[model samples]
Target: MKIYPIETGNFKLDGGAMFGVVPKSIWQKTNPADANNLIEMSMRSLLIEDGNRLTLIDTGLGNKQSDKFFGYYHLFGDKTLDSSLAKLGFCKDDITDVFLTHLHFDHCGGSIEFNKDKTAYQPAFKNAKFWSNKEHWLWATEPNAREKASFLKENIIPIKESGQLEFINLSEDNYIKNSELNFDILCVDGHTEKQMIPHLNYKGKTLVFMADLLPTIGHIPLPYVMSYDTRPLLTLNEKQSFLNLAADKNYFLFLEHDAHNEICTVKHTEKGVRLDKTYTFNEIFN
Candidate 1:
């Protein structure tokens, strides 16, 4: 099995919001804020190639949003989906499955693109069967007042409209069965309902895709939950439980949004599960 780290580009997000309840003084140490209080973040995605499957997890923020809309995030970087795939000798059409951890604009926006005529949005990976949980699909489609802004209709709907949408397990035991991906779904509700985190067995190691649940290494502490999460308390419990299990089992956490660290290990420190070590994908995967 082979895994590729796709650089979908980088953008800025308010550091305070990204680390809910955590003071800027603390988070700024790791993610220094710019003059606008925004910190640079990577919309990093993963590509898995094994047997008959090539799955891409999480598309970065797409390019269809208007300049005015993008002005807020200050999107910058030359590494796009096309360019990144080219580096790997593949294209969007080569993807057979698109496993979305959630439907947030940063995670799923790149899944679809605007047509040249600007009349309609279309699936970015036409050949890929988009994977999302039924609960998350509904939560994103019918977004609540708190998270409606994060769930853009343009980034979504097109996959379903294109007749390529598929649901993962609802009971928590259902894992997507593909030759390339033999992983369990770590479904959590704190950050939107039923957000799917893929736990994979790769190269004799256990790796987990830490979506928004643990956006950065700084969020290893249990209380460092995101303000965007619907249920912060639930998130705390889930994070603690997961961290304990991860520390015990020695799982390499593959971060999705962290700008610097791609993977990390945690320890059961007195302060909580603190960052033990951090490394790039190749450092661990290779």
Candidate 2:
């Protein structure tokens, strides 16, 4: 199996929102904020080429939203989903599966796009089966007031409408081993309901896709939970358990939202789990 990093785009978000109640004095050290107090973030996705199946995890924010709609996020960057795939000698039609970690705008917005005439929305990857779990599908479709803004109908409804949506059944333990996508899925509910984190065995090492569960290296500490999380207490426990296991097993964390650090590993420090090191995607995979 071959893996590649797909950088879709970059944007800025309020650092306070990203780090939750964590003081700026602390988080700013790792994720420095701009003059406007927004921190830079990357919409990085992962592409896995195994046999004939090319699975893409998280589609990033697509370019279909109106300028006024995108003005809030402050999107910037030359990279895009199509351009990134082109660089890898591939295109939308080449993707067989789109595994969404969650249905947040930044994570799955690129899954759907405007049709040729811009008359209606359609699945962005014409040949790909959009992967989402029943629980998350329901949660996103019927979003609560707090998360309603993040779950845009334009980005999600088209997949189901296009008849390409598929649900991955969750096990009793919320873990799926050797899923049809050819990897283990670790399901957690703290970030959003049933966010699936993918675990892949690459080069004799376990690589985990750190979705919102651990957005950046700045969130390695036990208390650095995002304010957007509906259940912050649940997030604390989930992070503690996951980070401890990640440290003990030496998993290479593939960060999805960290703009500066592409990957990271944690270690058991006296102050609990802390960032051990960081690596660019090419540094380890190239």
- Please give the TM-score that candidate 1 achieves against the real structure: 0.95
lDDT for each residue of candidate 2 in 1-286, tens digit (9 for 90 to 100)? 9999999999999999999999999999999999999999999999999999999999999989999989999988799999999999999999999999999999998999888999999899999999999999999999999999999999989899999999998999988999979899999999899999999999788989999999999998988999999999999999999999999999999999999899999999888999999998788877
Q: Can you write out model 1's per-residue Cα lDDT over 108-134, one digit (the tens) per residue?
A: 999999877989989988889998877
The residue-level lDDT of candidate 2 at 117 comes to 100
Candidate 1 off by > 4 Å: 172-181
Error (Å) of candidate 2 at residue 109 is 0.7
Instruction: Specify the highest-TM-score model's number.
Output: 2
CA shift of 10, model 2, Å: 0.3
Q: What is the TM-score of each predicted model, taking all chains together?
A: 0.95, 0.99
Those runs of model 2 whose alpha carbons end farther than 4 Å from true positions after fitting are none
